[model samples]
Target: MKDQTIEDWSREDLKNQWLCWIDTIDPKVSLKEGDSVVFPKKRIVVQAEMTPLVKSIFARWERLSPSERFSAWEQLKEATKEAMKDVLPSCIQCGECCRKGSPVLRVEDLELLRTEKIPWSALYTIRSGEPVTSHDKGEVFFLVDERIKFREKEGSRECLFLDSTSSLCTIYEDRPLECRAQACWDQSGYLELENQPYLTRRDLFSHIEVLWDIIEAHRSRCGFERLYGLVKKLKESTAQREAEEIASKIIDLTSYESHFRSFMAEQLNIPFDILDLVFGRPLERLLELFGYRIRIEKDTKFIEIITQEGPFHEEA
Candidate 1:
């Protein structure tokens, strides 16, 4: 769920969830023996005696105004930070955080993108699925699933926009909100406190508190859905020339499909002859031969292919 929707949850419910999560980690609480809690690289036996009280405070926090809420959240986060100082591990800069499959844009991000004069086609392209347009508001943006997939699969499991060679963002200043809000195990300063076992618990709690604060803020903002709507609207309202220009940037269909077929065949270690029988020939013939199906709408610039994995591509 988007942060905005999260914000809509009753304060009490949110608090209860938070408490439940913490309780799962408490050593003093009832936990099955041999049960383990996993962190990035560490797993610890469930202790039966520690109970951290964050949910109660969080519940009381909901009645505050946005500014006040943020402030309170920050304070709580600081406390957690102080407590968990010792157990946090340092990041090895594996670049997993910048991976491509995570969706970072929200409505505000899309609106901001519009302020620039770059043609939408040159700036972004729809992949994996059709652009979703808001029927009511006419906003358009990339779908969340697409964004997630892009982040997950593109550029070696890092973000496509992340420059691996330089360890920099291609769109640093314009990166999405989710990207900006991200903090992994190392960013919270817990690694520096790793030697301080007495402070480990506090530090871990603080890290989580900070994370939840961001989540709550996002829920309140409804940023994710807004971005989707914006992207959809843009696609719908794009000028014909602009749309064509964008379409031109996409890999030509013949080349893309050929390459895709070859790649898939190679990945699966299937023979090229079988691949041709599966994906080659006229659309109807291909469908009849191996249940391969394609649908191309009249006047649309792409073709949709139905495969065992569902509709795989809509390429120009």
Candidate 2:
């Protein structure tokens, strides 16, 4: 077969090519002579940097004229819908889809989740700061919005609803619209995915914005951004006493806990585990970056933020 240039390709061809490029490396997919692709087998890692070539492709789309863009979209949508008309694709039950990642739950799916078959524990939220691959932009970054999604197995990429032995959905009948929209035989299902409505933090937490506003206010006042500078200064100081004093002043654990607990309980009205994901784990990890280990004693409700090499204080 003769190699076809991207300039000669139709909009639908480009869309399908982009899909395959992101999904997996396949020889069947069309590409320029030297296009390099990365196939991430797990959830999109936040740290992956976009190459200049990928950035250029994104810029090209942004510069498209209205009429030119409309023509392209029309072709893209018609091709996707047409993939379903001829014959419904057959599923060999390979379980690749489940292994790739769990589906993001739609708002309508949240309503059905009230049923006994689908417990709330089976879900997980990818909050605003979590990273996910953008199907359109082909880049990964901290998401601008909170997304409710089905949980994956504890240490595996397979969806929680997928039965390992059978390669079938445990909650097949009660699966979300996103799951229903996927078809093993056709790429169209994945292409048309943006049409589905996703559930956000605001849908479940009525006053989350209030908590966010307070958190933002605290962030501005707290100087969390200066953490790295404090760490660097501590590393350079000759006196251990001075370093300890600086560390204590830099991390106001008391102030953070008091304000955070108040905002979580009174303002946000969210569960404790939600707070752990949204604030606790992140804060703990941040401290770890500065050579501190955080240990929470559940029995006595104590928090110990200690240095890796020296004596530390405990709080209750």
Candidate 3:
């Protein structure tokens, strides 16, 4: 019956349920190894009962309205203020924290980027499935799920703002909200920040949401998603001719990327760099994820592709 109940609980159902309370048995209360007490009208289950519950809640959070999410974000900021009251150790300039990874950008941090205080090239987004350190959840209960985070450079996990010689953040005065809130030595501080709401892509960049939507539409309408889906299918299929045909189609579609670029520029007035920042770069990353390599040569309008351990080149 417990298994059935678990199976029947949907992601939405889990979001609505909370751990109301748990029993606290006195230290002097006698009990046997195999014995259990029956509450007259209630039932009890193991602590592990909450695992799937939390997972479900986390997964479906994207379905929440923007207003709902922002409200939660505000609450978290208030909690962080309270958490900061705890005694935190002074920084000794060890550089360990700065070395670990870049401080992720919060909603308030976007202003720095908008003002060009931080260059876009120095920033990258860890998309929904990429591995990331969940500072909001802490290391002890580390979340191994895809939550969008604004990371620094690809090669070095260190923050771009770190000054190597001084072992201090170069942009200390303009550091992100997470950076200001962090307390490396305080366990309770970590716990307090756990499960706090994060800004969604839409929340941070609503001005570009229309562009994102258009790119998404193009991805669906064009064979972009289908091309990758075919690649996965080709990997599992036994037929060689079918595989070649799919690979050929994939190469053919690569040429259309320019058309997409032109269409966006002429119709939407978005420049090449901004388009690349918002969509093209991430699209390339997505293709790379599907075990395909794309090299675009703008000088000659050339594209190079490798699939099935072989090279394919297309020219515009």
Candidate 4:
């Protein structure tokens, strides 16, 4: 085949060529301060100083307009055809995560699974608005409110679509978004492990932090409105008066219990756990610090805040 000139190549052609060039360079080449290489086959040029050349290309690419970026990418590709194949590393499929019950399905995933006729059991109960639990040990699925029971004995622990014998997904073409979005070991060295193909808690926590930011933004927009509606329903019910009275008594007991524990702790200088044995939660400590005084009247729960000026009442 006749070699194509870089000047006559398309943007995609140039990119492919550049990637090919980068892939072909010997790791032992030891790129130095001043050196250059020319690929006559691809009709492209590359410099010896790896750091400066890469930095310049990336910086210039960042400053380009979207259309110009495409042009520059093509130019880079034409300049480095040997690097194209090195874009992503290979994956050795072990399917450990698939077998170990790590498949996380969002609500949208249900539609896909239903369409595919995948045999997966729903983990939640709609009644009581709480997660169902195992008959043996009452542990709820924290996020899903579903019990953690598997579909069949074999399919229960493994991903519904995973084929154990082949170590491949049966529904590879129609897998859920989570499966498609996951790029394990892309940045971290976790994928390098022979036994472990999963991310650790630290990596998962970092992902959760990013998700929390998104949740916080959404909450700022509409969380209060939803809470207000719930509160309003609680306030209007016939059981509202009884509930408020119970809530008031509980609050006062909680407040006094908190203060009493703190007083004991300060006087004895013991660890908070000892106090926790007597009284649960930081709310007790908080009540002591704030000097909580609560009073219930008719259907209203009142909180009296003691200030230096005087005491003031607030109704819930």
Candidate 5:
């Protein structure tokens, strides 16, 4: 095949060239290129550094748009992960990973939830399409599918399961698949595991017809995707008149969510948190995740978007 100039090549073509290039690098096993992580296979500790060829390809990546960069990164991760069927590394009881982020639940972990005494307060849902930190990258991106994650301790990112003093998992015997699969030394297993089917609200609650329908309706109405777009508009709208209109829509949506959460908590006699296992974290909390700070006035009916820098004002 004749080589097309890089600018003329499609992302897929670039990705293919990448696969072919990496395939020729060395016969030894390694996870993927980019991140400086080593994979121990056959006693071959392949030092993962950017070779000249790898650097050339990454230089091409520098020219890509943000969306294109993410797409290419995903494609590369998927393609390169299949080669890394690594030996699982044993844990040394360091809680650093747990302190960094909570494990995302996988389908294999569902049985634990069904049989165990883990409370709803301990877990929260990440709605499909919600922006969340990627388990592998730590970069915030919209999820392609919904996930349930164990909540962190109050005011800390440490996993609720991690015992800080002992550096042990409180639920060591019955940890989620993500936790079981994770190895800071060799993320190949974790990376491969990430592509597998994961638990969703539907998987847990779909059996109850009335409950499922209500959850679906609530997700459709109060989803973070809509709020994210509105907040983005709130940030970018240059016109005061248009900004006011956008802020009003934001407040109206917040009101609907507040009332629904209150009504559901009251009617079901379940803590408002139980609903978070289905619909996702409350809107106020999610707004902060999306990079907006929320404050309620005396009325307590609407959220005021506040930040150290510029924030949207309802009056203006």
Candidate 6:
């Protein structure tokens, strides 16, 4: 009778008969050791593969006194109620998605920029081949194409347009195309994002002759491809003099890039902070993407490349 009473609980049983608080756990897998879950009368240990749970040993459970069964039913009722409370019908206006990552702009948002509803300072460019973190993959990879994205608030990754106190979007009426399409409760819209064309830096500024000329010149001198090649040269140089020469070239490029951004901003009345839209990230951060770290001393700057052996310093 003891052996015959135990049986594997079906997922349907969890939903209907068992009322097993199936909301939090994956019902597809059977419960066993190492899995801890609140059952009707107990906290059961479960491991799906090895020791499948004897979750429906009805005869053994019936051995409990009437008071114990009453207490167990109360526990199950409360757990189910707690789990059901978090299902939201609509957005809570918490700005969690905006805080985690600002929406990537698309061609549709161009009108917003023209109207100055989304100010220029609130945007930044991710240049072609720049290293960017992928939230889906949890790894860094080079961006295949250039993109214009919203800038984040200072000292945090929250969207620049977010009003922190009330968790409201500052430009909700003229929010970016991606912002308008997103519905966290629904997943259907996000797949469409993958197929949409992103807005580009050239799309925004290439029409202006003077600004475009300077931007083109900067990309030629300080682009990720050129910088990464320099890093490779620095690492492979066998002689100290050759390594020093490579470092010097990198230093010259960095100096020239800095002067370029400052001068262009002043000439065009662009905010200094928004220069990333004009010229990708600063050379220092670009170098970091190439496996190099930089530090400054009294008069000298040091660039260190990390390798399999370890990092070795180079004076620039």
* Ranked by lDDT, top first: 5, 6, 2, 3, 4, 1
Candidate 6's displacement at residue 237, Å, is 6.4
**lDDT per residue (tens digit) for residues 1-316 in model 2:** 1386444555555555555543542322222355332322221111111233333343465456656555644554344333323232344344666776788777878677656567765665554534366543446554556577766786566797888886788778788877787654444666686776677645654466776665455445443344445556766779978877766655555346546655656656656545533332344344554456444466422224455542111100
List model 1 lDDT by residue over 1-316, tens digit each: 2455434646755544444545454322112365332232111111111114244445566676666666655554444433333333433333445642333234435544457521222222232233444312335533433221222332244555666675566666666554554434322342333232221112222355643453244233333333233333434545867545433323143334445556655755646533322232222222222223334568444423333332222111
Q: Ten-residue segment with the worst summed lDDT in candidate 3?
A: 39-48
RMSD of every prediction: 22.3, 16.6, 20.4, 21.9, 15.3, 12.0
User: Tens-digit lDDT track for model 4 on 50-159?
Assistant: 23444455556535566765566655554343332222233334454455443433444555644745433322112112222321133443222211121212325566
lDDT of 6 by residue, 99-153 (tens): 7678778887888889888778777787787666664344666678888888777
The residue ranges of model 4 lying beyond 4 angstroms of the native Cα positions read 1-92, 117-156, 187-316
Q: Encode model 3's per-residue lDDT on 1-316: one tens digit a residue.
A: 2453433444444333322222332112113464322221111211122235334435645565656544543443333333223212444444556666666555567777778776665544433323233444333322222233334445665666777676678777776666666544433543554455544445544577777687566545543345556666767767878766766665556556556767877788765545544443344444554557555466432224454552121100
Full-model lDDT for every candidate: 0.38, 0.52, 0.47, 0.39, 0.66, 0.64
The list of candidate 2 runs beyond 4 A from truth reads 1-88, 135-138, 207-316
lDDT of 5 by residue, 1-316 (tens): 3766555566556656655655654444444475445333211212111234334445667577767765755555443444343423465556766887787777787778778756667888877767666666556666777778888788788898899887788888888878887776667778787467877887888998877887878888898778888988888889989987887888788778978877876765657666778678777666765456555678654545445352211000
What is candidate 2's local distance difference test score?
Answer: 0.52
* TM-score (all chains, Cα) for each model: 0.26, 0.47, 0.48, 0.24, 0.67, 0.64
Supply the TM-score for candidate 6. Answer: 0.64
Whole-model lDDT, model 1 = 0.38
Cα shift from native, residue 45, model 2 (Å): 28
Candidate 6 segments exceeding 4 Å error? 1-86, 135-139, 232-243, 290-293, 304-316
Worst ten in a row by lDDT for model 2: 41-50
- Span of ten consecutive residues with least summed lDDT in model 6: 41-50
